[model samples]
Target: MGIKSALSKPFASFVVKKINKWKYHAVEAQQKVFKTLISSAQDTAFGKDHHFSTIKNYEDFKKQVPVVDYEGLRKYIDRVVEGEENVLWKGKPLYFAKTSGTTSGVKYIPISKESMPEHIKAARNALLTYIHETGRADFVDGKMIFLQGSPEMDKKGGIYFGRLSGIVAHHVPGYLQKNRLPGYDTNCIEDWETKVDAIVEETIHEDMRLISGIPPWCQMYFDRLSAKAGGKKIKDIFQNFNLFVYGGVNYEPYRAKIEETIGRRVDSIETYPASEGFIAYQDSQTEKGLLLLADAGIFYEFIPTEEYFNESPTRLSLGEIELDKNYAIVLNTSAGLWGYSIGDTVKFISKNPYKILVTGRIKHYISAFGEHVIGEEVEYALLTVAKEEGLEVTEFTVAPQVNPEEGELPYHEWFVEFVKAPADMEEFRLKVDQQLQKKNIYYSDLIEGKVLQPLKISMLQPHAFINMMKAEGKLGGQNKVPRLTNDRDLADKLQKYLL
Candidate 1:
């Protein structure tokens, strides 16, 4: 056996044992993690203010600390930025992970020393679990290319700042670094298009076995590789390629396109890593949802999505969550975020193993006229219609058309970029509208009462979404097209590219 395969076998076995232990005692593990986190931060400024010394249990913790978002924690983050020690955590953070924000220009999330290991460990366990479950250790015998953000970091106030992918890339294990592709010089290229070209030139002839990245950007890489190799499928170029690791966005929309590009069915593993923390991962090949990392250096709480926007909402711990109910995730991590709302909504699919599927973002919805349609509902409708019509959607977004001066009632406008357009546009539009109405009753009522007209479709030319992302300087890595918006900010920008 190859060196990597030999090493991975024992490592995979070790990961399986830990995963099984966590699975069987999920609640206990979560409680212990919470206690450990509380004790660790009890002496920090935030902890002292919230009286963490007297906080005895989950009930006391919740009652003392209010659920907060980025804006709510900006004061503490600002202090950290200003080089204040023990402002949030026990000491200054190692770095700040810069991510896109809703109201703020950019969010700088703290990554403390204690919490950084959880990110690396969770990622390692995810791959090891996949290998253990599927007996796919041979995948380690060849090179793996992770299309990540530039690894070169910018120092801000004595702390490094960059995208999470960039930060993680800089910390890849020395052993695996030997098997990674696209040398550091190429990876540090900031312009995505330039970086992709460099990557293609560097890896086109290598024995590449794995590819991992956000779906859309990976698709771009595959497309470029195909063009360079004379329209050859990825499998043809990398004959031993066995796995595709993806995250950052749902894979359903990109599955058909990716498989078509590869020319064969390949195994895929999904993860739920964010700037806030590493949340969950696909632990079992047979399971539909990602297993929650209950014992990681993060404490999790859930608020029902419907109640989240309320002035006061109920917070449910891991032990109290029920299956199939959408909840907004609140995290208190070792990174020093205290009861912070991550803004994403998730639904538990299995309570026994504690597996979850991210449903949508709390602020990423359309309720301009009280219709209240979420990203999940819209994605479901689009995927359903596309599947029935045998079409492949590249990217899409929805926005509200609320101007009566345009001579039509307010309605949801869908801007779609299709890799394979349906033969009949009218049929596609009608099916999408019907499915959405079925998914959301409020949307149905508006259409029925003529408060809103039928949803409108503005077909975008091929690569329009990619071009738009490029123009906005968010072309690659974890960035994605916001699936739904309350206003026309994105829609108006994309309308200029309609076919």
Candidate 2:
């Protein structure tokens, strides 16, 4: 056995044990984190302004700090961007994770020294958890690739600024450095297609075991690899490639396409990593959801998603959250983000260890007809129907069609790119629409009331979603097409690609 592979078993066991110790004491871990964050930043500008020193409990925190998005925190962030120390956190942040914004042009999320390690650790522990559970460590000796952004960074007020993935690229542990691919120069390639091509060429002959990336981007890589190998499955090219590590989005929708490309089912670990923090990881193959990172550098709060936009929404802490309810996640991180709303919604799936399913995005939903369709509902509806109909979908998105022909009422339009045409497209659409109605009561009510017609499916041409993303310059590196959109912007732009 290889030296690295031999040692991986013992190391994985140790890490898993340590993680379990914290997971079992999850409530206390979160409580300690909350207190530490408050006490550590008590003298900072934001802390003083919010009267942090006077705060004694979660109730005091609620009174002192209003839950806010980037816009609400922009004033302090602006000061920090100008190199102001002790503005938000204890000192100037170590890095700024730059991401595209909805209202704002671009956002620089702070990443402090204390908080950065959690990002790396969470990723490592995810793999360790897999190893400990499966007793498989041989993959550690094989090359692994993480499809991600350029590792290039530009200076911003003496704080390194780039994509979160790019910033994280710098912190990969030395031990895995030898087993990682593609080389530095290839990873630095700006264009995603070019990068994928380079990666295929660089790693095609190598012994690759693990592939990690957001699912869509990973699919793109798989496609390119297949093409390069004369339509051979991915496993044919890399026999040892057994594990797939992915984050940013759910892998279920892409599972069929990915496994098809690879020629076999492979083990995968789902993770929930955001620029704000590494939130969770799939700890067991048998588990239904990602294990929530209660002991990480983040103290989590959740507002029932329905009430997220309401005036004075109730913010419930980690210990207070219940199972099966969608909650808009709020963060108070060691990075000095206090009462920060990161826009993602999660539903607790497990209680004691606090495992969660990322249900949807707070900003990415369709409520045009007040039916309030979310990502999870749409995905569930479509996937369930697709499974029943024996259809494979490449990618899809949903938007409300507000206006129709003179006699026609409006309906939710699903733009689907199926792997092949279904035998009865109308039948498939009907089943999916019915499934959607089953998932969302409000949507069902709308259809039943004749306020809206049953949802319609608009089959898309091959690579339609990819082309759209490429056109928008969001082809790779944590960019995901929203499953649901309130406006017709994406849906309208997607019109030209329709079948």
Candidate 3:
């Protein structure tokens, strides 16, 4: 082994131990940061434009600044883009992190010059946690590949002002700049084909040790690697890739497939990254859930799911939040967003105020014939069925499809890709359908034929559905298959590719 590689194991271990030891301090630090932020929001920023600037306590804060969703912030963001003072940041922003939001078409979140420290620090904390756990500063001495968004953008003064990918590509650590994947600075937002080609070409030569991106995008890279290897097993591309870091969405849907495609059990880390902030991350060793970054310049509030969307959500301070309770996340960030609803949900795994499990997207839900189904419900159902049937499910997605010709109401149709096909798929499907119905009372009533017919299942050709997503311009870098589609148009599109 090379000198760097030789020292990696011991270094990585030391880092992990050190981080775990400092967990308490991290939590205390977060408490101080949150206290300061809430004070700042109340005293200076909140409602400064209007005359209502006396939000002192928690209740006052809640009442004064009504829980603002992304839609609520959209108008203000437009003004921010147009240089409206006091709307976004205090002064001129260094750059805008252009991101495609889930519900919003697209948005340019004005990242402040002052708040960049928070971003860098949070990201560095993430690295430090990994390093403290692993004890290796140069664990990734080899090339680092970022499978990110568009590289090409409008250039002024020979400088590119693209998207988030462009910003990171331009400002990445100098020594690691050349280590990034090709077209990291190119505008991936324009031509999908060209972006995919660039990604394919970039990774074809180097040996990648560390890679970061969302699941679908990483899958695209692995697929390209598979093709480039001339049908060589995925490990042939790079058995050396010891670490894989991913965020942006749930990994449960894509976990098994990624493992199969890569031909090895890779070390994976999960992160909670949004335009608001990088919220949490998972330990590479545990691989169970994420460790909430309390030191990341934000105060987190958890509102019980039962009380969510009500007249008032019962908010729990970070110290009081519990394990295993579903809560809609609320944030007060250094980015100048106060009591901003991030449109995501999470459950606590531990009470130390640092670890939690990502439940699902707030908007991503599957309601088949008036039965509301969320990500946690579906994920648990699948996990239970997979365990009971002794089946290894590789990847899956569910959508509600209404088939008028078949005289069927909108029912949940599951696309399952299995590692090994069960001896009796009919039996498997029947059990899954029954289990799903039992878990969801509304679906149970539908299965009883009074409301709707039994749930449907389609076993897809290996990677066929993912390829279909690619064919639809939804599978390049950072693009993902809709795990749960409620829209009729998207459901219809997915139905055509069903096997």
Candidate 4:
């Protein structure tokens, strides 16, 4: 409980051994999972209209089951609401996990009992690995807090769709279920404020150690808790909390301020979870990237990064996957999605297929100046520069901005909100510019031409980024305001508040 002695070198090596062992088995285990998937998918009740039958071999499955995005599932999603029991699964879905849709609006994604266990197992595995890394699993006496979205169920008592947090909430061990936030699995998401407040009020006394949620919401809770505590820092309310588990988007943007506010270097865990599956987790104490859930109840597929924009991408099976290659991740889930590209790209960090670094979202890239900068790329570059320059940046947003001079290339405009003022922004901007170029060759070329001018620093009032998101109806409940936007919509809306 006393920080576990900083995870020594020998202990770190032991943890690495466990990781390698798990990964080695993961490759072989995935084949068995694939075999089971292939067999079950062939059943008329399981496949046919649901698209699982399309998978024969891994290659055949890739060809038959075309990459499906959020838009592709719209029609079938309506079928789910109509109570078509097997539309998105083998049997009746236990609940519908609501996730935000781009054009279709809020969508209720059906969660099958078969896939639910996978979520639970992956989550537990993540926790176990963290414990292994820190050698502190034995000391976890405090309650594990999960800040999830609404858990409203429908006419048949199935969960209404919203966010992954709510969907995964049901998977929390039944033994610990009673100890969670008030009405955690049954309350309306609209009442999140009330529920969260009640949870804070109740748990303020308990030794709540591990807290997990999206950064903004957790920050909101911390802010409110701090205010309620009459300017007491975050440490007072959750006095025992040391580990912060966050997902949904990049954590680097808010890392510095969050640590400062909490008054400690908190152990932060990153997760790559989609409605399709709990894809990966950062198992190592070093916290570089996530280890993919290769043996989860999903058959994985990957398309080379070069093929991402192709009309018909040539897919690669798990067997063919190579390390250090960027691939757009696709999933063939037990819940009936086949060859579904979840729109995220990952680069293998090790030869082990199970470990990867989430590079970026497939569609969430900006290439206006021929610099193919994705969300993760920009995030890494910005974080690296900030760390090097010792700048205390809390939040930032980047968009493609065009300079109106004839024949000039469009450039990136960075909207940075720093917590502490940097003494020399000129040197900091130069460092950032260097990092940007180093990250991607095209971005560097653009910078050299003055196409993308110096990085812009915009000082914002306290909690400015979050407040603006709330004002735009893009905050609260399940909505996560994006840290990086490809277009200028968010930037345009937020320009008035910029310094």
Highest TM-score: give the candidate number: 2
lDDT of 4 by residue, 1-499 (tens): 3333343334556645655765777767677878887666565343675455555566566555677776776676567677666555565666667666676576666667788888887776676677766766522555667777665444533435546666666567775565565455334546556666776676666777788888877877777777777888877777777888888777777877787778788787888777778898888777466887776788788899878778987787777788877899988777766667787788887755467888777767777766777777678777897787676776777777765457655557777777776688767767776777787787777778776765555556666777787676666665665556677887787777776
Cα deviation of 135, candidate 3, in Å = 4.6
**lDDT string, candidate 2, 219-259, tens digits:** 99999999999999998999999999998888999999899
The worst-scoring run of ten residues by lDDT in candidate 3 lies at 43-52
Better of 2 and 4 by TM-score: 2
**Which has the better TM-score: candidate 1, or candidate 2?**
2
**Each candidate: how many clashes?**
0, 0, 24, 3
Query: Model 4: runs farther than 4 Å from truth?
Result: 1-22, 44-46, 49-55, 156-162, 182-196, 403-409, 449-451
Instruction: Return the number of clashes found in candidate 4.
Output: 3
Better of 1 and 4 by lDDT: 1
Off by over 4 Å in 2: none
How do the residues 1-499 of candidate 3 rate in per-residue lDDT, one tens digit apiece?
5565555566556655655664666657656776666544443333474223454545565666667776777776666666655554454456667667657877666565556665655554566567655655553567767667665556332222446655655556564566556643444545665665666676666777787788767776777778877876566776667778788777766777677787888666677777677787775565467877776667777888767768877887677777787888988776666667887889887765367888776667766477767777777777777766656665677787666456556567777767677788777767777777777787787768666655667777776666677677666555655567666655565566556
lDDT on C-alpha atoms for all candidate structures:
0.90, 0.92, 0.67, 0.70
lDDT of 1 by residue, 202-302 (tens): 99999899899999899999999999999999999999998999898899989999999999989999999998899999988887999999988888999
Overall local distance difference test of candidate 2: 0.92
Off by over 4 Å in 3: 1-22, 25-31, 38-46, 49-53, 101-103, 135-138, 151-162, 183-190, 368-370, 383-395, 401-410, 417-421, 437-453, 461-464, 467-472
Candidate 4: 10-residue stretch with minimal lDDT: 1-10
